[model samples]
Target: MRPTLLAVSHGTSDATGASAIAELVALVDRALPDVDVQAAFVDVQQPDAADAVPAIEGPVVIVPLLLSSGFHVHHDLHGIAAKKTDAVVADPLGPDPRLADVLAERLAAVPGDGQPAASTSPVILAVAGSRDPRSLTDAEGMAHLLEQRLGRPIELAYLAARKPDLRTTLTAHPDAPIATYLLARGFFFDLATRLAPGRALTLPLLDNGPVPSALVDLIVDRYEAAEANVI
Candidate 1:
């Protein structure tokens, strides 16, 4: 039997954010019909990993739907996997070039200051910051990928829990567009909108329109790579 793909996320209370994440899981389910795909949350939602992991029958691959490694991935998910017999945790979905492509598309879709964001124009990559140092490193790595993709300088800013917050970054750049580095709409995205008042801000990676193919592929790759070592 195929191992269960336990797609875990940092759950959100926002209805749209919840739906967006569910849709991504559904997309992955369709992509791998033979494998069982289950959704679970680390916080703020039901069917959590603690509950879901024990219920699966076969080997499991726990794939974090988060953008970076942090408290949730290290303490929360790993702790759960450590207790299981044939479960493995996969890497977070970010710090990849495909995500940079999605970020670039989002920037292109929105005009900056009545004009397109120029390739040379400085852009801020706004991430939902974390206190963990590894999370910070991953955020910076993502910024570098996006910078190379956009052919522009990228400034890494946090929404909360870190310095150089979004509001402060906006003040510093004044005219640079903010590329939303979040996976979906949630408290952080709402906070970003409230802070940016009249500025260019791109939508999160997964939006209401449709799930990005890159995201689905990335998740599947994570599961497959980890599944290989599940014995």
Candidate 2:
């Protein structure tokens, strides 16, 4: 039987946060209309892991809609994985090429006023907590992708762990600040917007907003591209 795709997030106590996650879930649902897709929060929401995991009718591919590997991705997800006797744990959405394009597109979203990208803006690839080393790789990839797409430079910043905090990263750069988020917790991630006086904007955790249809296409492509692998 075909597996069910679970788009999981850290889940927040705020009502708005839950709404945002739900919005992303809807986007993924619309993206892969043919597949059996559902949403679950590792915390702060109903249907705990025990409730969510065992109910799967077939194999489940848990696609964490998160940016980097953190406690949630590392410990929580791993715990869930240990219990998933019937499901397949897909890799966290870090380290994916489409992510770069999505982030580049997010940077492109700032109201640029028709100015040349190279002349007008620089971006901070803002990520959530970052203990894992792979976060750096993902950040670096996003930076390169943004540069290639916009003909400008972009730096990396972490909201929690790692060096170069958001403020410091912005100060290190000479160009006006723009933050492109690469994380699952959208509301928690969006705070970076306030930190930037220039223009702090974040891409939606998923969907890519105006380009929902395009993101849906990418999801289809990813599904088609999915091969036999254990993560």
| Top-lDDT structure, candidate number | 1
Give the whole-model CA lDDT for all candidates, comma-separated: 0.92, 0.63
Task: List the pairs of residues colliding in candidate 2.
Answer: none
Candidate 1 structure quality by residue, lDDT tens digits, 1-231: 889999999999999999999999999999999999999999999998999998888799999999998999999999999889899999999899999999988988886433644757789999998999999999999999988887789988899899899888888999898999999999899999999987889999987888999999999999998998897
TM-scores for all candidates: the values are 0.97, 0.79
Model 2 off-target regions past 4 Å? Answer: 14-17, 31-34, 117-121, 183-187, 197-211, 217-231
lDDT of 2 by residue, 179-230 (tens): 5564444445556666665554655545323334444444444444442432
Candidate 1: lDDT over CA atoms? Answer: 0.92
Question: Candidate 2's error at 145, in angstroms?
Answer: 2.4
Question: After TM-score superposition, what is the CA distance of residue 120 in candidate 1 from its true location, in Å?
Answer: 1.1
What is candidate 1's TM-score against the reference?
0.97
